[model samples]
Target: MQKVTLRFSHNNPSCLPDYRNHSRSLKKVLQELNIPTWQRKRIPFLYYDDELVAAIGFFVCQAYVLQESEPSLHITWAS
Candidate 1:
């Protein structure tokens, strides 16, 4: 398969179907952001390696992103 450095976005994650993992991501976002139920409905999702392991902001959730010459990407965030 070809390697791609997905410019991860809530509008588009460029990944495959993974509902269970995606749900977990929703939970994480809810817990992390402490957003209300209505607001929680708004935050989009992205899947990294078949898992919801990252978060991105609409205007800005993901703060730092580091890339290597590999398919793997490191995403970080801080309050």
Candidate 2:
């Protein structure tokens, strides 16, 4: 399974204790299975910044996925 270290923000070095464990499990399962791209799921997390945050999961059903994506600035500024 693919593993990744996710930090909600630069200020928060660690995730909440409760969610830290579960989040790890979810990520593992998601990585191992052949999930579809259109199937959207949200991984709930507890941010160290004292707030709850969630990472939206989108499985591309492909190998070697990149953890993050760069927004299309041109599209955003076009309007």
Candidate 3:
């Protein structure tokens, strides 16, 4: 069985994704929009005509926490 592993470092509280194999990151995406990368709770979400365009990943805070299990990621793409 193939098992996936998530590295959780106690040194850094923020759970950042591993970018070793990733080409484009959140910072790269936001750079296209000319937004500065800052540690914040509310990230800049793009919306068009009341609809979510894309997630640039300029999040300000953690979305949520789970009690006994891994938290589910929910993206609100407005329409």
Best prediction by lDDT? 1
TM-score of 1: 0.35
Error of 2 at 20 (Å): 19
Q: Tell me the lDDT of candidate 2.
A: 0.32
lDDT tens digits, residue span 1-79, model 1:
4332333344332221222223233454445456675765555444444444344453222322334654654455443
Lowest lDDT 10-residue stretch of candidate 2:
70-79
Q: How do all the candidates rank in terms of lDDT, highest first?
A: 1, 3, 2
Per residue, candidate 2 scores C-alpha lDDT tens digits across 11-41 of 3222222223333333444444555434424
In terms of lDDT, the poorest run of 10 residues in model 1 is: 12-21
Candidate 1 backbone clash number? 2
TM-score order of candidates, top first? 1, 3, 2
Model 1 score (lDDT): 0.40
CA lDDT of each candidate?
A: 0.40, 0.32, 0.36
Off by over 4 Å in 1: 1-29, 58-79
TM-scores of all models? 0.35, 0.19, 0.23
Residue 49 Cα positional deviation in candidate 3, in Å, after optimal superposition? 26
